[model samples]
Target: MRGVWYRRSAGRVQAGAVLVLAGGLLAGCATAPPRNPNNLCSIFQEKRSWYHAAMRQEAKWHIPVSVPMAMMNQESSFRANARTRRTYILWIIPWGHISTAYGYAQAKDEIWHDYQRQTGAGGSRTDYADALNFMNWYITNSRKVDGIPVTDATRQYLAYHEGWTGYRRRTYASKGWLVTVARKVGHRAQQYQQQYDACKDRLKGGWWENFWDWLF
Candidate 1:
């Protein structure tokens, strides 16, 4: 009887381990970055849910889908687990990350908490939907707080990288590299806008097509 009990306990442990491994594999697959990060249409085609989420955000926030999507691409290349590079200690050993920015949006810890508190939404940065929604909310607020136009991806990204107060203080003018990066983000937004215009109707399929896609 003792031997039988021990065998059953070992079997249960092995089963639990297998279950944990399976869960990890599924999560890794789910968070894998898109194959074509440069092409907005291809990215959306590959991830229909992302297109839907972007459309939803646009509808709710009155911000164009291309703007935030472009900013996110610049931020993380759409990688779900992206984060700041680690610092080095004494120029040799590795230290903690330079900043607390992480996940698809690379949002800092403080701003992320502010988003959660203001929106009352519970979600992690690793989730594409949540990150996009957070971008929408923050960009909309930038327009309200800083008078930056929603269509001006350059200024909007400046405000995004620098807080509203920093934008008001014109701190970004001193950071030439940051200003160049913001211009690149703006160019990418224009590219995404053209691509989105061509494919949006297809993405928003007929009811039956939507149902079929949902079923599959």
Candidate 2:
């Protein structure tokens, strides 16, 4: 009876250990990405690290947080897994989605690869930090190569959409629709700058802000 009882207790302990391990795994997986990303305050509230990520980009690349935030808002509405729509055939048939532009910045494969190579960053577009950094790098380089001021969200976004070569050739000039969208992006960036300035201190003082305080 003693031997049998000991075996039963040991089995129970093993089962409890397995349950605890599984519980830990599930908890780790349960950490969701940010919600209500369109609203800058909600974004910071949902994932405070985002504020730090933006700041990091600005400090490193001299690109404002509002610039990339506005670009992401226009590109993907800040959806991490957003994809461009596919053109339809006969206004009814389905087609493959346009470009490999995914995640917040909607960075294409070639452009994203170049960014990774240049920055030594191991993150993908789905990562807010990586996306924000990519935007800064793009904007900063645009300033250097194309003389598009980083602060001028209009020309920066035009270069972003049309590519530096296309922007130099005035390709966007012919695309009235694209020009309109770039203007909107520029306006939104200005608004975000004002909004960020108003609440940045409070945002930096949040409970989770300490995690990245040292980095900034």
Candidate 3:
């Protein structure tokens, strides 16, 4: 009888522990904004700092805010530590043969090396913010040669997708895949902007009213 009682108490303790852990997870999810809310396959979230930093970088460098955001969405969905070194997309089959790209940004060999030299940043090798910074520098330079405004996120985004040579050449055949990717990124960026606007509009009570009203 005592053994049965002790076993039941132990089981209760384990159940309680599980419940606490589950609750903590739920709470974290509730507070953290999702990277891909539509795709809940991964239990991942984006950081707030990157959003602010990317926005500031765009304005400061005369780049586009949507460009970075869109890239983040597609590249790693703003997941900072997005793994890029995984060679196995499938358990038995490896993804890369001769070359590989890693990080939230999915930078390849030359890009990884260049970014390391230029930025003095590394880790996860694929973080979206690092990727954003890299593209910010790249696009700014590419825009001048391509006769496109670096401040125009939409155009610059397209240019970044196409690379400097492709942008300058305007090689439609070479840019076919890039064009498709850019269109998808544009749509996703528009969606995200709309979401941001809606969220601002739905600010709870007078909490954000001061800031909003102060603006306009």
Q: What order do you get sorting by lDDT, best first?
A: 1, 2, 3
Q: Which clashing pairs does model 1 show?
A: none
Model 3 Cα lDDT, one tens digit per residue, 35-88? 464421222124434444555576667655555556656766545455455467
Candidate 2 global lDDT:
0.82
Error of 2 at 175 (Å): 1.0
The 10-residue segment with the lowest total lDDT in model 2? 26-35
For every candidate structure, what is the RMSD over all alpha carbons to the true structure, in angstroms? Answer: 3.9, 4.4, 7.7
lDDT of each: 0.90, 0.82, 0.59
Ranking by TM-score: 1, 2, 3
**In angstroms, how far off is 59's CA in candidate 3?**
4.2
| TM of each candidate vs. truth | 0.83, 0.79, 0.56
Model 3: CA > 4 A from native: 1-46, 79-98, 116-124, 151-158, 171-177, 197-216
